[model samples]
Target: MLTGALSSRMSSSVSSSDRIFPPSSFGSFESPGIRASSCFSGPNADMNEYDETDLFSISWNQDYGCFAAGTSHGFHIYNCEPFKEIFRRELKNGGFKFVEMLFRCNILALVGAAANSSYPPNKVLIWDDHQSRSIAEFTFRSEVHGVKLRRDGIVIVLKHKIYVYNFMDLKLLHQIETLANPRGLCCLSHHSNTFVLACPGLHKGQVRVEHFGLNVTKLINAHDSQIACFMLTMDGLLLATASVKGTLIRIFNTMDGSRLQEVRRGVNRAEINSIALSPNVQWLAASSDKGTVHIFSLKVRVSGLDSITHPNSPQGPALFHQNSSTSIDPLVSPNTGANPNSLLSFMRGILRKYFSSEWSFAQLHLPGNTQFIVAFGSLNSVMIVGMDGSFYKCSFDPVHGGEMVQQEYVRFLR
Candidate 1:
């Protein structure tokens, strides 16, 4: 197994029968009394067999290669492509609220659920599966809302504060205080050379950006209402944010905190569950409470030299792109491929802005009652994981930009 190195390479889809978990690989030194549930059926087929409330949390690793599912019994790590459960650790009295993996290594950062007396919700346990015990721990006065893991450092998110610590020595590196962030909303860039942290500011609808590489801090007033959900690209060059209203999502340039693009989700209010960006930065995916996944095309491209050009320059596409050696200027052309403007769109600037807001190029529909998180899979494809243990792998039409085709589905938990 390539567990030592962090791999972000994407893979093609496989057959459904090929994804079944191998019982032979279920037994491990770290897990005791681990057993698989009975076969799963339709969506509403079997509710009494298992407790739905046992599922506490689910999160993707830094590279989106694998994801950790935390339940009241224990936690399970599953590979993303074949959708197989790699391994699990089910303690006798163990349950977890958060199980964060540091890449694909044996090390994990765990925060306990309230039901498990073996692990406490207020403490962060650094567990090394190879050693079969926790190597270190950090206990806070209150429950931990979230935990983020990287090779070099560990971040702990509390209700009103975030703490950064060194992974090697567990020494305190820095501390940040923010508004009442019950959701523990924060994002960290995975790029090794650039370390950027995005978290809520001390005020409403504001985000604080920490450039650890340059020792700088920037504050961006992103939205009118409080920020509901946001995401940072793997390279940390771009950020996407949505407010409490959930009608629009704004993309910003992290380096300059400039608004690059604004796309509309809908007029009705909904809770934004998750947001994702393609590895090539060509597409952005977002999920909400309405049970629809929106795919917005960020079709910005420069034909020739890097010079300032009007949005209607007729040469470049309508978004932003960043290179390691060259910096792309921030440009906004919200109506890249959306429908033509309405009759009243040209009357006022504000009216034009609303009518010209970009719409999703493609969409996918699932159960409206379930919450989901999405990530880009292989080229032109997406992966959706729902709170109800549903895993869907779907592909989109890059050219047509309409409904996405479902390629695979599995009830991974049952």
Candidate 2:
């Protein structure tokens, strides 16, 4: 076990939960185009350059075309088009614990940590930054891990349960049961009444889903191994799940709860930190403890890109949604793992606690390491940010040969 002092000494300057994604893809580098910036390279905004000593958190608002950042100093918002700062609020208080924005609006949910007096650790304040104070606050007895906001309501996740509250009045609407989850793996449909929540299930290798609008609970017997990570699309139309094995990644249809396709992440067991879908739900990106980031094409079925490719190369979209009927045919069942009764399978189960290697289709090896968050900047471009405050923007041309070019980079902390 890592001692507290040693763990603190080895910890990264930033953690995955503190990073943010660009609201949309920036492939063209034209509209919300970000050219190489000398902002942090030279005279910076307010001379507030990022250093390892600061605790920072960030998020991007596509609707507002801006990004919000929280630091030990204070919280601020910046525009993407011109790559300039719009405003920064100075607060030496724990700055902000978990900060979330609503479509570039003045509405933000602020969770305070040790330093902030405006709110407590268990309280979530519906912040009206226009007024620079909280208009509504919800208090709980337990420490809040994270807070998620949707148009209809807000979801607050605890270690064992989840609560959904109405946005207009902050009234409790639904309470859900989950496993011991510290990260709050909940994703709400951006435009619909649906939301997906995963918690520990009836047994090992199982996951529990609480669907709000549909009024149903789904138990996906997805893997023989324990579930590692899962994510829902913005529209809640699909779900991507990975197991502890880290050898297979499966996509599901939320409407009927059917496995649509399965793709191999690798044959080895690795710790996966994050999985995210593109704005169009056509691309799926993931990152793990291996110090390698992977982007998988979801435009086609997982049986193989053979059907949708240009018929010359084995690269293109994995048309999961388009040819749904054919994609689910029994003959093309993707071999995710070995037979349940195989001797090798039994051996793997016993040896899983040790380390193993996993492979990704479109992988970019990072120069340094920590858990990272993966997001699509544009259809052809991806952004990878390490918990240690390392940032990278890489663009790849998958059709010809998936070669990633580091387009831009910046270190948030020295």
How high a TM-score does candidate 2 get? 0.69
Each prediction's whole-model lDDT (CA): 0.74, 0.58
Instruction: Note the clash tally of each candidate.
Output: 0, 12
lDDT of prediction 2: 0.58
Per-residue error (Å), model 2, residue 149: 0.6
**Of the candidates shown, which would achieve the greatest TM-score relative to the real structure?**
1
The candidate maximizing lDDT is 1
**Each prediction's TM-score versus the true structure:** 0.79, 0.69
Model 2, span 96-206: residue lDDT tens: 667777776778776666565544566665666554434555566677777777767777877777787767644567877776776656665565444555555646666
For candidate 1, give the lDDT. 0.74
User: Model 1, range 1-414, lDDT digits (tens) per residue?
Assistant: 312211111111111321111111122322222232222111222223355436778999987889999987667888989788887765445578999998899889888888767567876767767755455556666788999987778888999989887666555688899999999899988877777789999999999988787787888899989999999877666789999888899888777787767789988899999999887678899999999999998744323233354445556543344443132233333333443333545674756456667788999989749999999999699999999888899999998989999999988887
User: On a 0 to 1 TM-score scale, where does candidate 1 land against the true structure?
Assistant: 0.79
